[model samples]
Target: MDTHTGRRRTDTDAADRPADPAFERRLLAQVERLIAERGSVLAAQGRSLADLGDVEEFAERMVAALPTRHPYDESLGPFYDTAGLVTWLGVSRQAVADRVRRGTLLACRTADGHLLYPSLQFGRDGQVRPGVFEAVGEFTRRGVDGWAVALWLTTASEAFEGHSAVDFLVLHRSSAAAVQRVVEVATADAQSWVA
Candidate 1:
């Protein structure tokens, strides 16, 4: 039962739904590919399969050795390339580059070194949200990578009563104090690891 809505929750609700078999198959395939790639890399480094000890232990170590994927990688996005940003913002490509250089816009760099900006930073008016630049500045100053900052902004947080910073900004545009508080807390937490 959903007390807030005064309605009975149904199994049809997304949260209660079962995983899609096709998605599960894709995930398993990716895991297999990852293990194979890792094994090949190990062989090239002069460590054969025999050196990996037991097969179960080899699988465990290979999985653990895989690099963490960015959280946003799973999302279907309106991610902006440099050309897309130039058109969307009604600005030149150089202007977009300048904003990135100034840390006024957060962009993730691909392994190929191209920048992609998530569309969530833009308001309905197509302008950058007021506190976004400041928040990005704070995170970058504290040495947080762009992907980590993007993940933090999109994730719901109990610290803000379960609203993600981006959602909080959309709902409370007149003030970004909530988002600012989240940024400060993230910066402090990052600093603690170094200390």
Candidate 2:
């Protein structure tokens, strides 16, 4: 038979039901105790469910943590020149020597009249590039080492018609040193050849 609560009577109902009112009260008390001892059962679900509800909270806390843009230091690197350092600096053949005399720029001349300067020390504006303080935090956070970077400035054959180190910037600092040494040797050789 169906009771007013809509529960169906079964053969075991009489046996399963607590005979004493106190026993029924005790069972109810135990259930209430369990509910109190544990947290809301929904809290025990997977992290994904928690994450879905926490998205707005997480965004509120972390929206400012994301960066807005990349700085210019991320784009600068070691660049090279062709047709000698004089031509690269847009100066006459004698201008590099003049700068050397004036103590404005450093230049090591080769025997064949070729001059080499440290291109990395100068920026596109003929002035030293600023240090990376503005973007150093982001650059360091992303683990970028500017030493290994290179920017190749190309020149047409007509501009540098018969140059040796055209269209390539040897980025490796050690490689630049090696090239400078070669220029030193060539300067000595040229001095000897002229003598």
Q: Over the stretch 11-51, how does candidate 2's per-residue lDDT look in tens digits? A: 66566435798887997798577644443554565333354
* lDDT measured at residue 76 in model 2 versus the true structure, 0 to 100: 34
Candidate 1: residue 173 Cα off by (Å): 3.2
lDDT of each: 0.64, 0.36
On TM-score, the leading prediction is 1
Q: Write the per-residue lDDT of candidate 1 for residues 77-172, one digit (tens) a residue.
A: 345555445544557778888887777888888776867787777765666676665667667666677787787777888765787777777777
Q: What is the TM-score (0 to 1) of candidate 1?
A: 0.55
Least well predicted 10-residue stretch by lDDT in candidate 1: 62-71
Count of clashing residue pairs in every prediction: 0, 3
